[model samples]
Target: MKDRHWRTRYRVGAYEVWGTSLDSEERRRNAPHAEPADFGLYLDERWHGEEDARTSHFVYWPTLEAPVERALLIARIKEAAAALRDGATVEVACFGGHGRTGTVLCCLDVILRGTTAREALERIRREYCRYAVGSAGLENFLLNDTGDLVTPEPLRAGEGR
Candidate 1:
């Protein structure tokens, strides 16, 4: 809500992914799909305002530290995917939707769609837009050979799988 400059939406697999560019009002107006159940992922700590919240399809806040943790990120994406499959529009946003948000988006692509982290990051930039992840550290993190892309195993609340 704080004057989103650039916003664009596009389909990624079975989900729609996008973010505001920066200081572009026009993009914000026509950005998100006009659905009530959309889910948004806010990367930054800034307040996006009450009106933005009310009108948003759905929103998720994952306040990550400077270097994002893989386990936490995977959990958040799982949550987002669940929401999206349940008839909600989803948005993942950081300050510029580049560094933090972009990194997470890449992870989501690999984890959900079976792309390698490196390949997924590259695909995100090539397909979504350049300047997606601004930090070299974040880019490295996404592409690191950190085992078999650790993801949360499905948990049954009251019973064993």
Candidate 2:
């Protein structure tokens, strides 16, 4: 929204993820041109919840170059994927709106649509952000750790923590 300067929107399976930058957050708070988020998955090394919106369920994920905590990553991905499937407008943002944001969105593609890690990653680069999944380590984690199909069915109510 606004000037399309900081955010790039994508549709993966049943969910819509807005890959955005911190700059968008600043612009949005000062004068919002788009609707507020129902959920936000923030993947960044430094930035936390500075623009906390009352309407959003924001999760801070400090990632990139960190060890692949598969359990935690899977949990967060599931939550964001579930929110997207439920038709809630969600935002996935990081420092540049390129790598980290792209990585998570690709993971959501795998969880929600049962896509392969390679397919998911390429999908993000082709459709969402061309230079996404920024870190080679991050990419390898998705390729190796994330099972081909982690969830066969939609998670039951209250399944995510």
Q: CA lDDT, every prediction?
A: 0.58, 0.68
lDDT of 2: 0.68
TM-score, each model?
0.67, 0.75
lDDT of 1: 0.58
Q: Per-prediction count of colliding residue pairs?
A: 14, 0
Q: Across residues 1-161, which tens digit of lDDT does each residue of candidate 1 receive?
A: 33233446645577766554333556456546544225565655453651232323223334433354555555666677666567666666665556666776776677557777777778877876676665676766667743445565788788675
Q: Tens digit of lDDT per residue, candidate 2, span 19-63?
A: 777766554564255566777766664445443233444444566
Which clashing pairs does model 2 show? none
- In model 2, the runs with Cα more than 4 Å from the true position are 1-5, 24-33, 52-63, 66-69, 153-161
Question: In candidate 1, how many Å is residue 148 off?
Answer: 7.4
